[model samples]
Target: MKIKNRTLLLPLAAVLCVAALTGCTRTSYAIQTNDARTIISDGKPKEADSGLLEYTDANGVKQQISKTEVKQVTELPK
Candidate 1:
């Protein structure tokens, strides 16, 4: 019974370790508006044009905004 419990615990411990390591990775971005409000997005933004920017949100949907509406763009820490 002791040997059986040890075998199960070893695999469980490995899985938990992997999950914890992966959970620490989260990429976020910030878009500052002209009004001083910041929008936290899921990923980086793509340059659509001289006056337009595009990016995906946390819900996996694509979105676009005008560059004139943004004051600044930056990446958040992981």
Candidate 2:
């Protein structure tokens, strides 16, 4: 019983370890707005239609703001 349980847990443990390591990696970008507020993103903001800046935020949500409202966009140091 112990041997079988150990074998079963080995693969599960490996899967969990890989998931933990891969999930922790993310690219951080800082977006400064004209209003003096900063937004965090997981990727570089891109120009979108209707003069909008689009990006995926740190929480993994898709976001868009007016391009005119953004002061600057920069990637954060790793």
Candidate 3:
């Protein structure tokens, strides 16, 4: 009874510790748009975000990306 509970507790504690240490790792990237202007996250080129780009992934459909998701700020053609 007590031994069984202790055994389960050890494994559960270990799992929780690992999860706390390694949460979700998000990487940010710069994406080029049809427009020459570059948009960056954090309102700066040197800043980073959770993900490189923020896009809506529909069922079996092309990814709908937002212009603001872009992580680069550059000049656009006039």
Counted clashes in each candidate structure: 0, 0, 2
Consecutive 10-residue window with the lowest summed lDDT within model 2: 41-50
* RMSD in order of candidates: 3.5, 3.7, 11.4
lDDT of 3 by residue, 1-76 (tens): 9999999999999999989876653333334566664333221233226434443222322243454545344432
Question: Compared with the true structure, what per-residue lDDT tens digits does model 1 show for residues 1-78?
Answer: 999999999899999999999987668899999998887777788888567888887787888889899999999887
> TM-score, each model?
0.64, 0.66, 0.32
Tell me model 1's lDDT, rounded to 2 decimals: 0.86
**On residues 1-78, what C-alpha lDDT tens digit does candidate 2 reach at each position?**
999999999899999999999978877899999999999998778897789998998778999999999999888998
What lDDT does the true structure give each of the candidates? 0.86, 0.90, 0.47
> Model 3 clash tally?
2
Say which candidate scores most in TM-score.
2
Misplaced by over 4 Å in model 2 are 1-24
